[model samples]
Target: MVPQLYCDFLQPDTTARHTFTVKPTELAYINEHLHHLNHHISNLIELRSALLHRSNQLTSPTYIVPHEVLSHIFNQANQMEWRSPQQAIVLSAVSRQWRQVALGTSKLWERVICQGPLKLYRDSSLLIQHCASYASSLDIRLLEQGYKLGAADKTFDTTTTVLSSSDVKGKLKALELQRIPSPQWIHMLPSFLRLESLSIISGHHPSVDLSSLPLSHVYLNGSTFDSLILPPSVLVLHLDDYFLDYAVILLRKCPRLIEFSSETYILTRAQLPPNLSNPLALNSLEKLVWYPAQWFMELASATGLNIPVINNLELKDSEGLKPAPFALLCHQISASLESLTLTYFSANDDWSIADLRHLFTFPIPTLRKLSLTDWSHRLILNAICALTPDEGEDGYTDRCLPKLEYLSISSQDEIFGLEFDFDYRVLNLVKRRRIGEDSPFHLDFSFCSDDDADYEAQAAWQPELLHELKEFVANRPVTITIKGGEVELDQLSTARFDDGDCSS
Candidate 1:
């Protein structure tokens, strides 16, 4: 299909070394393969063009009626009331074609959820059946009562033996099960055939062997994965405290894994993974993420990942991090980091303004984009001033973040010189604290989010904030992202700040 494929046919194999160079059989075989591939390629191009044309034709807004129709559907889906989600499911049931379209579209059917015990279990089964063929990604969440059902059926659900028989279980490419009431339902999950990404939260554990699971990417949060075992096929893994043995098991069993993030635990105790005995390190690794851990620094020191330049390392719960070692790493990170994010953990009581200055002591000569959230903006500003090109300090006239251009901050106050002459730019900022505490503290962490459900009620979603944001959008191109609760922005050229108390 490619030039390389053609070239590969020309290359001599081991047989070519020992005998008469080119055999007619080899030539014929290669020719047949090439001819077959060419047919496939021609078909592929035609298919692609057809799909593009169809997509354009269908996506164009033809009528306001359709928009009005879809708006009510989405409104029902997004509603906070009890039957809202079920109502979303019911809307799809208006007709077989509608059901097919709604379930086949990955975004619409991605989240297969129902709260409490819906009388529509029969209808839910139909959705599961519909998704079996169409779903590329799946998120199955049960309401509290649904959780009870999962708990009641725990033993029956978490089994490979049962999953193989289930129709909806096989087509799950990326599967997420959230708020599972019981740990027993895991057995009923389908075995991994095409499954690549799997996330299980607050669910029951599986009892059977998962060696056949085709999982390549995994994320386990807020539940126990102590019983879950990933096959060596896993390439990327994410874990929360619910699963502790993930890191240790992967280190020992998963030789091909390249990316890993786990908040389970960072310790070198008796429970330390068997791989730690003489932990073999990965050489093929390119990216690593470790967030909000009590022993993050110690784990960093223990792993061989202290490579001179880590591609992009994030420090979440930065409040837990001590100043000295973090400063040391920041200096080293300057050598190779392309992007860095420092998210403040809620536990930080003594988080200081001085820590930012420490980064200035050593030039982050290679740093390009720096994001800081929840801390004092003045501290970061002071650091910029250090890199500031004063007449006597540097050979140039003005250079703050000489190589650094984009910055995202989430603090209450405004810090200046961000646009000071060096191609530097402010990307965005967001809120760090809850709304009940203070209004402007919401100005922090605008550049990012990971799901702020821990304090949704505390989030500032007031009509006023939305009104101001809408006004800003009217003036300039803007992106307003709300994840669970927190809101963030991209560029705030005209953001107004109210002077408010921001006590630690």
Candidate 2:
């Protein structure tokens, strides 16, 4: 649409005019043309809006990424060490595409952990419902962080109702409760059909029965021996303070138990039934552990149960204890045992050091691994050195462990009352072990001292010994490791090797 003045003055034969008179007819014509241009501008704006919407859809990375790859990305993001469920919630809220991918992936919503108070049970229930249908197995943990154990005002009924409801029951596979006040309502813990592992960590005994659950692993951190009534389906049981009789009852009931561990209390020898004379055979038991080194002596004397096929044994204590009973224990189970660990928790007068040397009295041919933690001394080092083949006119006779392969000794205690060295005696043992052929033995030795120079001397032993041992065997199979800390060792014990220092 041309302006009226241009149309009138700029004809082919007409002269150009700079001024024109205003007329009502030309004014209406100009208004009509302006309305048409306004419509064209509006149409161009609508076209741009439509085209940008199409461009966003075409350029979005979500459209480029295949659904299979996006699902894996969501799973990887959720696989990080999640301290709380809020982390997963934050990932889902990143964008609409992220929320869709997170919801579609079942593994992302499989585990839900809620800490602090029963009030969060409702929140957890909602989360469980959201993930219930797709998740094949659900793991939930409700922790009462600040509540006092056995407090009268605390109630876990709300938590029980939410967990026991139909929405969250059959799908629960793992549940961990930390510091819940009263778990008496946990009798229904067995009703979760697919539940595999349950851990209740508190300071009070809730008198809850777990005998109906087919749980593979159960850890009752604070329950007493009398209150524990385990089911037959339990494959592993770890208790805090258990009695001799309760241990017996548990062994008799759970024949499928693979491992049993506890912090045992010392009880009387008379607790054993007078009519029972023979040792009960624990055919399926593989590992037995007792803390407070004296408990091993007390229980061995009290209950004469024989673990015919046990593989691993560990004992820890602080008080000075005799090794005779421990030797007898090794004699009973030495045929099938593979690993033994003896730990002393104190650094007093080295009274337990003498007892540690007596452990080699009973020969364990099948013993493969031995750990002596916080009990490292000159006497114990002699025991290990004694394993070197005694090259006489006849062959070696005092070979204590024929098949032994691994030995670990760590000394983290202060050296005020204890003293030892990282000198030639230990170095010679490795050289002698490699005299005939490649020996399969490996020693892990760590010492703590105040001298950094001592560490340099100690650390040099490994590479020096390795260089010499490889002279015979093309590839030396023996490994000797040495490290040092803040404890002091004068390294003067080599001169006393001829003093007949075997402390029997």
Candidate 3:
């Protein structure tokens, strides 16, 4: 509504009679200008008040993100390398109102990580305090930051003896540490009170043994084998290359081991136990694995129990070199097997597709995940392709994969063979041309011994032929993992290249 004075003074014909210094016309003009200025200021004030009111409504009340989302964010924070602190920074800068909300929320600040820029992990007990009663899994990785291992024996710079320091109270499920002090360190492990899964990562440190630890499930690095005195009642034991010698210990001690794996380890003749009173060790064991194949023994001794509950068997390229022995070993595996893999254990026998097929003949009725590596992919996929006809009229696809969920094949060993190639036979693949001649290829798939670039270089190699050999993968229905870690042993699996997707 217009003010009465505004309407009266704005009329040109009317005048401010109270003004004696000027005429009524001049007074009318001055009054009009003042009225217009007042109207504009009032409009601006009303707009500012409205904006302020709406902002207050937003700042008030509990602004909560769902717990499921918060939990997911926490999980990401726990696993993130460079993203956690950035997230905290972004939240802090949203606004003063939001800053208060974020600062007051102790749950968001509780992810205590070690080795971060802030170095909250130096004193775990203090970090744990911030978590209070809501602490979840605690993952502590021992790093090679300062200490170094002796060439022969394992040593620790700091002996975690007070032992009270490592002790953790709560439902601790996972404990990850690197460059652990020694076998005794695992015995004195602080989180052992109630740990469900434990990983000992010894990056460049000597291997330490853990045969005697009471953990239910154990994952070990190859260098962690400084020494191990396994507990007889152990259930699940995973040994990397470091524990290849300890396989005998596993056989003797962990009778109840349901699952076991190694990176690349050798069951050398040197470590082969003198088939003593316990001629058959690991009798109660179930799942068995040796990845990045080294060498396979025929295991021809008609002794040892039929791995009863064992379902997964990963045969790496190394398995191909010792084909006869490995094949014979598979015959003794559990009849209820669900997955079978023939991966590039290492460069042995040039890892031929045809050779692998010759070994794996018996059908595993319960097999679901069938995987292979290098030419083994062609071998396994060819078998699956044969088993599953292009048309569904045959029972190949129908009865073949009734229980199967995943099938993966990797080709990481194209440059190298599955098993160890003696200095010469490797040249045969390099010289051989692709089955088809009219193919245009650019990269050479030939294996050569370059001495310093240190590889064995191919002298007269065809580029097209090599590319075909390197990238020739058939799209099969099964989930495939064509690439895997490098570890050569009897099993050489770091080679899940053919193993089902463990990432999910």
Candidate 4:
């Protein structure tokens, strides 16, 4: 129809030799019709484009997916650290259907990570407000600005504006503040009434008090506080590079704490309060992880601090393990400790085999599971010797950890080393333990090596050892597993012993 109307305007010029004169009013009339024709053509082109887009969307596989499934995918993507806020924004811009799903998924907006110059705090606050409107709970992270330029007055003002907002204070459930520059920011923490988990890393302040809030988990790393207080509602507490004296003070206040972990806590025994002489009891504590500092060893070994019923204990020391203190500490908790893991990364000469033997000599009758990681093969052998039953005048008797049923030994550098004696001893211990027990016994060994020569050396002896182990446990109530080096036993049958297992 448009082409036909345009052809009508050209009809008067069809004769080639005809001379014609047009009046200004007649020319104006022709110009008006041509302008209208161009406008209608543009409208028809836009309509065609719209229809094509809609057709593509209807046939696309992504558009066919249910909104609930897409929303869940968006939520999972939002959980990733790298994807986070950018991923959520990108998802909302992909298409109409995706934007609707992304906006409706509240979890995608729950985590708001704010990190930039002080000038952006207002923007971050606005983002928090917008997110709070859609999410009932918020996990906010205020990361360090990385530059201290012009941060003195502006830091406090901007941080307060962002953190003290009614939406932030009311909706925040988890808060992580990293390298907070000003002490005033610490004072604003108590205003977050709905906060349950808080992590403050790498800052120095005179004091910190969270007793007013109903916190269930708190993590403090590379931070110093003169006076620290925790509420009894705290269930998990982790302190790294903090003062041991302060940790002791905080532990005394948290009676309901179920899990406590301390790593590299500065030891200042002289600064300890006089009342610390009284036995500190954590009756409800279930798990204790201590990366032992010297003061931690002395405090636990010398003092009367008692954890009556700790079920899981993990002690990892990279320097070296002191035998006397470790033995005493184990004996103190031996009654109720059900699982024990010992990890050390010291040079072979720094610790002696006798030390390892002495540490395990204490009878932890209640301990059913034991794991030793990154220890020298010699030390592991001594540990096995200590746990093995000693020959008495009458018969095999006086075995340490009489109720032990599970043992796992993992070494990243060292293997059994050109020696068959360790293999025989391990087999002997397994056979003796499984003899009169109706319950199944589990033994796992993992030896990994970065050096090709070392791995090959380990490979040479691993097969024979695995074969002997399989034969001993064949058709018996015993489970033996081996991994790392050149071993690949995972598929051979939960029963095959010809080759070792590889787990990497």
Encode model 4's per-residue lDDT on 278-298: one tens digit a residue: 787788899988876345575
lDDT of 3 by residue, 411-488 (tens): 332333444331122122212322112222221121222233423222222444334333432222211211333222
Ranking by TM-score, best first?
A: 4, 2, 1, 3
What number of clashing residue pairs does each candidate have, in the order they appear? 22, 6, 59, 4
CA error at residue 188 for candidate 4, angstroms:
0.6
Worst 10 residues of 1 by lDDT: 427-436
Best prediction by lDDT? 4
Q: After superposition, how far is residue 444 of candidate 4 from its true place, in Å?
A: 2.2
User: Highest TM-score: which candidate?
Assistant: 4
Candidate 2 regions off by >4 Å?
A: 1-91, 95-101, 116-122, 144-158, 241-249, 264-280, 318-320, 345-358, 376-379, 385-398, 416-419, 450-474, 482-504
- Evaluate model 3: give its TM-score: 0.51
Please write out the lDDT profile of model 1 over residues 129-164, one tens digit for every residue. 444445465554433344444333433243222234
RMSD of candidate 4 to the truth, in angstroms, is 12.1
Candidate 4 lands at a TM-score of 0.71
lDDT of 2 by residue, 177-203 (tens): 776554554556757877778887755
Instruction: Estimate every model's Cα lDDT from 0 to 1.
Output: 0.48, 0.57, 0.44, 0.66
Worst 10 residues of 4 by lDDT: 1-10
**Following a full C-alpha superposition, what root-mean-square deviation does model 3 have from the true structure?**
14.5
